[model samples]
Target: MKYIPLRESKKEELEAWLNKSNEILAEMKLETNPKKRRAIIHRNKSHWRNDDLLNYLKKLSDGKCWYTEARFVAEYPQLEHFRPKSCARDEDWKKCHDGYWWLAFDIENYRVSKPMPNVKKGTYFPLREPAMAVCDPDVAITRESPLFLDPVNQGDAELISFNALGQPEPCPEPAVDLCEWDKRRIEFSIKRYGLDNTELCDRRKELWVAIESMISEYATNAKRATHNDCKISKGKAEQLIIQLKKYLEPSQEFTSLISACFLSNKVGKALYPKLLTQLLAA
Candidate 1:
C-alpha cells in the first residue's frame, strides 16, 4: 500500500466538521436531563451522517480500504469505529449509552473502512497489554490488541514483504517478535478479508506472467540476432532492453524482478544501463 497524503482543503473540511461535531457533543455533556442529552445526540448524528466525509476519506486513500487495501466503493464503504464503544467493563446503562454516542461523533475515532477485513467474523484478536503499550497513548485504545502496521508510519513496511506468489511473508529483519506479529497480522488480514480466496491474487499473478513473457520475448529476439551474426550489435541489444524495460516500467510487480535480475546476471548487468535510462524516461 502507498502512503496517502491528505490534501490541504480536505484537511480543512475535516477539521470544520470535527469542530461542529465537538460543539454538539459538549452541549450533550452540559444537559443534565437524560431526555435532552438523547435529543442532542440524535440531532448531532444527522449532521455527522453527511456522505461528504466518507467521500473525502476515500479520495485521500485512493479508494483503498484503510487496513486491507481492498477497493472501497459507495455502496459498501463501512464506517468503522476506531475506538469501539462496546467496552466489556462498562456497567452503567446511561454511561454506556453516552460513551457510544460520544465516540460515534468523534472524527479522530472514525475511519472509512471496507466490510471484509474489518467486519470478518472471528478475526477480532484482542490486543495484548505489551502490544498495546507500543501504541501511541492517544490512539492505543482504538487498536484492538495484537498490533498491526500503523498507516501513518513508513517503518511499518519493513516488517512485511509480498512474495512473488502474492502471499505476505516476514522480511529478514532480525526482530523475531515483531516479524511474528507481522506474519500473524498478514495471515489474519488475508483470512479476515478473504483476500487469499478471492481472484485478486490470480489477477496479479497473470499480470506478472505477462511481464515475464515480454521480457523473455525481448531476450530471445536479442539472442537470435547474436547467433545469426556471431556478435551482438550494441544498438540492437540496447533497443531490445529498452523495449523490455518499457514493459517493466508501468508495473510494480515486474520492476522488482528486473532490478534483481540486473544485479545478479551478467547479461542483465550488461544491458541494464540502457534499460534504466528508458525506465526513467517512461
Candidate 2:
C-alpha cells in the first residue's frame, strides 16, 4: 500500500458521467425505501467503471492494486469503491448501514484493486466505533474513523511492516512506534485485505531471499571498495546499487514489502546510508 495522489481524469467526460450519476443519485435519494435505493445503485453502477477513469487510475499505481500492491496477471483489475456504494457491512459481516451512495460516481472514492482482495473485502468497512457511522450523505465523512488502512493516506502505508517470513505485521514500537489505534487498524486491515494468504506470503518470502542475497553481495563489494586500490570492487558496488533501486521502483509489485524487508535486517541497515548516497549519485 502506498499513497496514491488522486487526480481528475478526462474532465469533460467525467463531468458528463457525474451529471448522469447525480441524476440517478437524486432519484435514489427521493426513494424512501432502502431496497429501491440499493436497486438504483446496482442498476447505475456500470457507468462508474469507466474505461478512461480506470486507465488514469491504472497509471497512478502502474496497474497494481492500491491496497495490496499486487498486479492482476491472469484476471482483469477491479475498480473498488474505497467506501462500498450500495451497502456497508461491519467486520462481523453484519449489515451496518447504507453505503456512500453519493460518492458512487466520484473518482476520489475509487481504488484499483485485484479480484481476490476485492471479493474478500466485499462491503465490509470496519470503523473505530459503529456509533460514529454516518448514513446521511450530507455528513462530513471525516467524522468517521475507519479501521481499514487506506492506501490513499501515506501514513497508513507506513503502519504495515513485512518480516523475513513475508508476513505483514503492524509495525512494533521499536520499528516505528505505532500508537494503539494505528496498531489495531493495521491488524484489522491485514486480515480484511487478505494480505497474509499463503500464496502472497510465499512469493514475498522468495523476493526477500533474492533481495537479501543481493544486499549481502553489495555489502561485500562495499567492504572491498574501502581499499583505495580496488576500482573493480567500487564499480561492482555501484552497479549493485542500481540493481537494488529497481526493487523500490513504484512500478514494481509489492514495493512496500520489498522496502520493509530491505530495512528490517542488520546488513541492509549497515549499508543503508551508503546505498542512499550512491543511488542518488547514480
Candidate 3:
C-alpha cells in the first residue's frame, strides 16, 4: 500500500460526529457502570457513519480500501477504527476491553478498509507492550503503538516489498536486517491484510510480468531501431504505451506492486530514454 496522507482539514466537516463522540467519552470519566458506558460508546461513536466523513474518505482514497488497497465493490466501504473501539486483541485474540474509548470519536483514528480485512482486524489492536491507559488521549495513543503497520505512515508502507511472483514480503533486502520486533510487526501486517491472498498474488504477478516483459521489449526494439535494424511494430509500440499509462498512472489498481516494479533500477534502466522521459514528465 502507498502512503495515505490524512486530511485533518476534512475532519471539520465531521464536527457534529466528533462532538457527539467526545460527549460520550467525557461522561465515561465519572460513570462507573460498564453497561452504560458501552451503550454510550456504541450510540455516540456511531456518528462515524456519517456521509460527511465516509464520502470524504472515499474521495481521498480514490475509492480504494485504505488497508487492502482493494476497489470497494460492496454497497459502501467499511468505516474502520485503526484501534478497536470496544476492545483490543493480540494474535491470540486476547481481548483488552479497554479499547481506545477516548479516541473512538476522533476522526484521526478512522480508516476506510474493506469488509474482509476490516472484520479480520476487528478490535485487534495488538501492541508490543501492555500499555496502561492514561488520562490524556494524545499521550495514551502514543503509548499504545500498534504492531500492525499503518498504511498512512510512509515508513510503514515502505516495510512491504514484493517478489516477481507478486507475493508480499515484510521487507526489501535493506529491511531484512531490521530488529526482530520491527520485522515481526511487518509480518503481522502482511498476514492481517492477506497480502499473500492468491487472487492478490495473481494480480501482482500479472503486473510484474507485464511490466517487465514490456520494458524488455521496448529496450530491445528501441536499440534495434537506433541500429538501423528491424524494430517493434508501430501497433505493438502503441499497445506498450497504453500499458505504461495503465500501470504507471496515479491511483491505478494494485499500484503499490506496479510502483515496486517501476522503482527497480534494472527496470528503469531498460526503459528507452524517450519512454522514460514521457513517464517522468507526466
Candidate 4:
C-alpha cells in the first residue's frame, strides 16, 4: 500500500464522529440497566451511520480494503469495528466494548474493508506489535498481540512485497518467519478478501509485463541511438529521465529494475549525470 495523506475535511468529519461516540459511551456508563444499555447500543449504531464519512475513507484509500487491498466500493464496503464488540464480556460490553471508547471516532482505527476480510473467516492476520507501538501506543494493551499490519505506520510496508503475479510476499528479512504467522496472514488475507484471485492477478500480471516491455523498448532505443549519432539533445534526454523517474515512484518492481540497471551501468555514461541531476531535483 502507498502512503495516503489525510485531508482537512476528513479530519473534521472524524472529530464529529468521535463526539457522537463519546456521548454513547457516557450514556452506556451511566445506565446499569441491561435493556437500557442495549437500546443505547442500537442508538449509537444509528448515529454511526455516516455514508459521507465512509465514502471519503474509501476514496482516500483508493477503493482498496485496508487489510487485503481488495477493491471495496458502494455495494462492497464493510464497516469494521477496530475492536470487536465480542471481545468484551456482557457487563463490560454494556459499559463499552473496548477500553478506548474514546477512540470510537478515531479515523486511525477506522478502515474501509470488505466483509470477508473483516469477518476473519478466511484468516486472522494480526498487526505487528512494534509497528502498532509506533502508530498507537495503546494498541498493544488492547490487541495483546501483533499479527496485522497497520496502515497508519509508513514503515510497515517494508515488511511486505508484491510479486509480478500481484501476490503478496514477505520481504527478504531474516527475522520474520515467512512460513508461520506472516505467510498465514498473507494467505488468509488473500483468500478471505479475494485479493489477486482469478482476473485481478491476471490483469495485474499483464500490466507488469506491459511496463517491462516499455522499459525494454526504451533501453533498445537508447542503445541504437548511442551507436548512430552518439549524441541526443539535452532536453530530450531530460524528458526521458523525468518520465522514467515518475514511472519508478509508484511501482516497486520498476524501482528495483531501475536500481539494477543503474548498478550494472547499463544506461549510457553520458546520460548518467543528467539522470542523476534530475533525480536530485526530484
Per-model C-alpha RMSD: 7.0, 2.8, 3.3, 7.3
Residue 29: error of model 3 in Å?
4.5
Candidate 1's C-alpha runs over 4 A off are 5-10, 27-49, 72-75, 87-103, 121-125, 130-146, 172-179, 215-282
Worst 10 residues of 1 by lDDT: 88-97
* TM-score per candidate, chains pooled: 0.58, 0.87, 0.84, 0.62
Global lDDT of each model? 0.52, 0.80, 0.72, 0.51
Q: Who is ahead in TM-score, 2 or 4? A: 2
lDDT of candidate 1 over 1-282, digit per residue (tens): 333343223467677777887788778667777667667766666665577787777775667665545455455687665444333111111222123445657655555666664565222333444333222223435445443443433455344444445444454333555645566665554554454644555654564555455556566767777777535554565666656666445333323333444433455555667767766875
Task: Write out the backbone clash pairs for model 4.
Answer: 126-147, 126-148, 127-146, 127-147, 127-148
lDDT of 4 at 138: 37
Model 2 TM-score is 0.87
Clashes of each: 3, 0, 0, 5
lDDT computed for candidate 3? 0.72
